[model samples]
Target: MPLFSNVPALRLTLAYAFHDPSSLLPHQTIPTLLSLPLPLGPSLPSLDGTGRKPTIRALVLDKDNTLCPPETAKLHQAYINKIEKVKECTEFSHSAHSILIVSNTAGSSPAPEHEAEAKQLELELGLPVLRQHPDRKKPFCGPDILKYFKDHGVTDNPREIVVVGDRLATDVLLAREMGSWSIWCRNGWRNPAMPGRDYRGFFSKTESRFERIMTRGFGNTAPLPKAT
Candidate 1:
């Protein structure tokens, strides 16, 4: 099984989260990513105190809970509606190139079934899925993700991308690792119509609670990227 695929990343993320909980904090928190304004623009508040909006050329979205229910491939109707609204309301368009889904279970696991799941998600969701990577999962997969976007002709600059997900440790940390911005989905998809659990387990819930408690009082701002 690929369950162990995230063990290494998890260890590192835990240490990082404890040492710098603010780094795992979200720039903005919403019920779900679907609520984020489409075609995010400079009118949005600056991530830092500099008052300069970061460019948004592409988006990296998490699948489980963030877009759909945890451990499921089905896209919620709310998100589907939101995507259609985005296409109609703005020039910004979503395709396999402009928007991508990054999921630890569907794509980044080590098992072959995970690869098949990724392909299935691509076909069902109408967006590209990052292919399975044995060692590159979230936080650690930022470089691979950047290369994927670059090769696909999306923006090459990581600063131009925004990573949206429900998990602070993986999703938020991934953005920090990639030098991109982050949007945290605090509640995930909570619609009663959607079936299945939102969080993976008690560990997921406890860690998130801990991170929230630790990050309290810190402003909602993206931390400066480390020097290359």
Candidate 2:
């Protein structure tokens, strides 16, 4: 049986909810309209690069939630620790892959806040950051991310690349759209139901459940498929 038993029913209801001309909550319903499912295509093995193995030559990381904990609005000393963790966990050998940051921040019209954060991240992580507008159109990962890797001579093999982020709406969805794997860090942002004193709050079980539903329903539109 399919995981979402009521897929067709839900889709029909959502279609009526969104497209019915006389619907009362059109505005509220429109935002929930689902896109066509993106095919998972074929599976690629791990990018360790043995023989004809797929070459994953870049790692795109999200800043606020994936690498650095989100509680601190701006960069802080704790970021250094996160940077270290990224370096240690990611495959960053001189030959195979490079790491870059992809993120969004808010501020004035032009949003120098994201730029400043990128600069701080560069200093802390000792790597370049690729920033994109929050409202990136289709090809949601942004062209610059691809350009950054191209300019640096990074390989284009999807198996060799991975994107890590906290928000499925932005990071995971974007990565999946770009045909790259994604890792969702369960250490940032929390729904009210999972409130706690420290870092545990953001890593709530409720958030996990929601993410699971969204990810499964959305196919590869998630950061990391549920482990096996």
Candidate 3:
């Protein structure tokens, strides 16, 4: 047998994931989600006028309120069409560009449940999904998602990859650490900005007009916001 054969069963265990707060933009900036440039340009070290305009070739997204309500395990009713359009933007050649869901669910849920949920997401989205392995919760689990990228031939080209999420600490920091593009999407939940602040909220088209219209879509959320 080779040094390491195929993967083996993962032992159930408590997991933890961390992010570098200094590496991320302020969490409050997410309120301006739709205000940022679409398909964010690559931040690679500039080479005088190589002028290869960067194109977004891949996306790594968060799970919870970013795509669906917490633990609903399905695409949010509102995001259905918007996600499809975003999918179109990430597509290259005949196949859709890789869109991965990387989450730190190990601390919160058992691995089996997370795996099942990820499978459902893969079915609905027609893309890949990655979650913390039962034996390895993030930051250790981060390698699992990265391994999938490596296995699938995702390159080190930062211009071609992105990570979108609701939290700046985890998602943004992950992007920074990985040297990939970052896009933060905000919802009515999880405000780490206000340490002790307590409030409840709901999302509706009337209030979340941007989400309802999905103006921050590819090419649309340029200098002038456009919608599909």
Candidate 4:
């Protein structure tokens, strides 16, 4: 993966995150997406206590680390039970399009190689994950994502979608850009081979460390969405 492939995204993230470090914070943080409260129909009242409620209608998930181990196209063994539990919920099982895995690697390009990765992930997870054009990568791809949700009958409102990922620069920043909710996976899947170990790589670990340092003292409150 090229470090500077998405210069625009990096620039946007740096500007907003530095201007308001809180923008880098997520509405919530969890070990994994499946750890979210089930049924997934309830409204998340604003933390600012203005009675603002954003009901989630769709989910935008990151593939690497957030789902499986970093760079893998399959689910972590430790997440298998969680996946089974999530499947029981009507929100996920209702429609294949309700949840999407928007990985920067697998599906964020027009290349056939990326398309193949997307297909493999969909097959492994039994979900309707799709590929994206190179310009449609996260943070820069927020509008394209919203359009996808609308086209798929998920929801036209950006506030109704939530982005879940392990990265602050990409995932959380993407949600902030979209005026949507976000959930940061503080700890990704546990390594099945090594119990009690986080499944991550050196690059991911270093990036996460940098993110923490950059967003220190920030409150984990999502930015309020614009009125429809």
Write one digit per residue (lDDT tens) for candidate 2, span 155-219: 55554566655544445444554666655555453322433523423323344555455445543
Error of 3 at 63 (Å): 0.6
TM-score, model 2 to reference: 0.56
Candidate 2, run of 10 with poorest lDDT: 24-33
**Could you tell me the lDDT of residue 60 within candidate 4?**
87
Candidate 3 deviates by what RMSD?
A: 12.3
What candidate 3 gets wrong by more than 4 Å, as runs, is 1-22, 26-53, 90-97, 106-110, 134-142, 188-228
Q: For candidate 2, give the lDDT.
A: 0.45
lDDT for each residue of candidate 3 in 12-118, tens digit (9 for 90 to 100)? 11111122213333212343223334434443222234665445566677666466555556554345555666666534322453677776551224557766787
Off by over 4 Å in 2: 1-55, 71-79, 85-90, 95-97, 106-109, 133-139, 189-207, 213-228
State the C-alpha lDDT per candidate: 0.71, 0.45, 0.47, 0.71
Candidate 3 pairs with clashing backbones: none
Lowest lDDT block of 10, candidate 3: 9-18
lDDT of 4 by residue, 1-228 (tens): 333566877787668756876777777767666577665535354635656555677888888777777776766655656656666666656666878778888887767777788888787776666567687687778888888888988889887788888877788888888888888887765565674777655545765675566556442455565555
TM-score winner, 2 or 4 = 4
Give the distance in Å from residue 91's predicted Cα in candidate 4 to where it truly belongs: 3.3
Worst 10 residues of 4 by lDDT: 217-226
Model 2, residue 211: C-alpha shift (Å): 3.3
Clashes of each: 0, 2, 0, 0
